[model samples]
Target: MKSALMGSLKFQIPQLNFHKTLKKPRPSFLRGRPRPPLWRAKRLSTEAIQAIQSLKLARSSAPRLEEVFNNKLSRLLKADLLDTLAVLQNQNELDLALKVFEFVRKEGWYKPDILLYHAMIQLMGRNKMVEMAEEFFGKLENEGLKPDTRAFTEMIGAYLQVGIIDKAMETYERMKASGCDPDKLTFRILIRNLEDAGKEELVDCIKKECGKEAGGRFFLKISSAQNGKVAVADLQYHVLKCQKARNFAVSSCEADLISTLLKLQSRRAHASR
Candidate 1:
């Protein structure tokens, strides 16, 4: 430092002003990192397309599109499709949706999940497909999915809608028989469908199944909707109708005319007397 001061004095020139010269730029800090894409697949699985194609190409007793679901396709199936089927059922597209569902089962990639079964039950009932719904119920049971009140109740309502009271009542019995608690909504729908069909025996059976719980809150709407006609009265009328149906069970009825042998027999009896 002393030598530089001495040299400066010696040099007697102040032209080396490095601080007054140029300056270099500094870099700013960076933040967020990029993320990987979720699903990179471009299209549906080959198995699923084959299944759908097969179903479309099918020739069968049922609609002929059943072959589409010949085998299970885990990658091809989506939860959205199952949910869409549920909505379609409400729109009375049950058979078609069920056709798709059959494919779902046939794909065998996934066991029929609980949600799928429940949706099937709901679809069957909403579309008035009673027997098919019952068949679906049997399938559910066979697959070891426990029936809740909703499952059995939906079946009961469906059977009642089609005037299959015996099946409806049987569904009720089977519900309890299967260890499900019967909810009021089910009974209400049951009573209503039965009453509509005039199936007194079945309605009575439902009431009996309901026992003291017959006076369910749902029944309140049924009563009010009927202008407060009591369920008991309704049930009795249905029973009478069922009996009337039974007394005349023939598909076609023809009364037989009196025979000549009967008249001859009567004449002989009178002469003998």
Candidate 2:
């Protein structure tokens, strides 16, 4: 009965032109081979494409960077303007990005956005204009905007990248005070910076705060059954070997100093007993 019913129900496949489905329509003006792996490629907004072309022309013909942006570009759709700003950012034309940013800011419908402010701060910081970066951050605060974790992280990185450890630490403390929890990337950035600066004591404290051991272990992984438990000396030796192999700026001397301090404190405790 099942075979009879299956025979009675005949399925017909729809005729689809597979070749047509595989082909993409190309504009008559564009003559080039099709780019493969199209899924990863981003399609630019019309305004962004126009902005790129205008920027190129301005670079060749215009004497000043400001000449590229005119009243017409300023009147673009809000989303398109933002897209153009992002394109300028990717192109590393930060000066042009700032000019466009100012124009956008002055518009009647403009509103504050944290990502925009963050990008502005990062751009200034990258140019070594730390003062302007700080000014932008201050402006964000004046706007009554509560900065998110990325904002705090970017500021910390900006300060650290310029060798301003004090400012970085202050920013970090401020982030914590604001109830924003730092993630592993934040911890690693501060840890690596402090390690390079030879601030081993601070690194130890930070590691402890983040629930990591002195050698940066997330959890105590002991192969107890295989090795019948590893000795403290053996563990220290292995950790030092791993550190040397990794070639991290974290020096062996700092680790040794920490071990020496631990031994001294232990002896002192024994004497007090």
Which prediction has the highest TM-score against the true structure? Answer: 2
The per-prediction tally of clashing pairs is 12, 0
For 139-258, candidate 1 gives per-residue lDDT tens digits of: 988988887887877777666555677777777877788888776576667766666677778667656555433222221112223566555322111112333222222211111101
Give the Å shift of residue 271 in candidate 1: 84
lDDT tens per residue, model 2, 72-176: 476578877777777666555776787788887887888888889887877676666778888888988887788877788778767866779889889989998
Error of 2 at 54 (Å): 1.3
Candidate lDDT (C-alpha), each: 0.54, 0.64
Q: Which stretches of candidate 1 lie over 4 Å from their true place?
A: 1-77, 107-109, 126-128, 197-273
